[model samples]
Target: MSRISIIGTGNMARALGSRAVAGGNAVEVIGRDASKAEALARTIGGATAGTIGAAPAGDIVILAVPYAHAVPLVRQFGDALSGKVIVDITNPFNHDLTGLVTPEGGSAAQEIAKSAPAGAHVVKAFNTVFGHVLAACTPEDPRPLDVFIAGDDAGAKAHVSSFVESLTLRPLDVGDLTSARWLEGTSVLLMRAMSGKAVRSSSFSIGLTVRD
Candidate 1:
């Protein structure tokens, strides 16, 4: 298992950190609020907590913050993130949930990738799954949630896939980083669906199931 460092102490961070610890991976939670990060780490168990800009000790660092804070956060990390696989798990959505917030011709992952330092591989993943589902489901769940991954680096994608599988989630490689645009779009649709009467409950999640 890989060491997972998540740059946020919010809901997504706690959910992912729980899975990482359950998978026997060393988890680190870093946030702007040191106390909040420490509290999250303690709640997740078997994880460490620290403030942002401290050198990430894990090979895989997850940007679990909001879309607005992601680029600048990566920029702030700068060279400290070099040689690390950075996972961007953000949905670039408008406030009303009617559409996406990404700039024209740009997705959140692509924008974050632009700000990433050299030697860092930016992978887009976990944007499609809601934090509620991530918090509820585990390796013991009958149906594992699907985590769609997109990245330019094959090795980095594989590394992320291995981690996802370790947590008993299915990893779907949807091709290069350009595919992230569609994944972000999917997130918007899923959000709208969840808010509408379609999903009915917050426990629902999206996944790909193939049958011969």
Candidate 2:
């Protein structure tokens, strides 16, 4: 069982923490607010709670905060995150949601990688899935959700893929860290698609199917 530490007390954090618990993995909830973190831990059932900067108990740290806060959060964590796999779930979409807000030629995951400690492995994931859907399994489909992952380190990617599989979710490796740019774009596209009146349901998710 993989130990997981989720940063942020928002919906995404709760979603991931709940899934980790359901998967029988150890979970730790960290947030800026101690009360919220504790409450979320209690809600998730079987998670420890702490504030930001508290040494993470999980080898995999998932950042569920806003894209703008990702960089600074990494900087603050510094070497404390060394040797840990850092999962970047933020979508760097513009406020208007017209497009991604990533710096030219750089995705949010890449930017976070730059600020992360030398030994930290940064992986981009969960940007394409909606949080509401993440909180629970898809209603119409009994299968687990698909989680596309991109990262520079093979070992890191494998670690994340294993964690995803542990939760019964499909982990699709879309190549190295640079592929995160495309993933971010996909997130923007999904956001636009969901915002349109054509799709009224929130239980659906984006996935890949391969026939044998």
> What lDDT does each candidate get?
0.92, 0.89
Off by over 4 Å in 2: 138-141
lDDT of 2 by residue, 7-30 (tens): 999998998888889888999999
Per-residue lDDT value at 157 in model 2:
96
Report residue 194 deviation for candidate 2 (angstroms): 1.4
lDDT of 1: 0.92
Residue pairs in steric clash, candidate 2? none
Q: Model 2: what TM-score?
A: 0.96
lDDT top scorer: 1
Model 2 / residue 171 / CA error / Å: 0.3
| Candidate 1 local lDDT, 86-181, one digit each (tens) | 999999999888778888767999999899999999999999988878888867878789999999999999999999998899999999999999
Q: What is the C-alpha RMSD of each candidate to the true structure, in Å?
A: 1.0, 1.6
What TM-score would every model get versus the actual structure? 0.97, 0.96
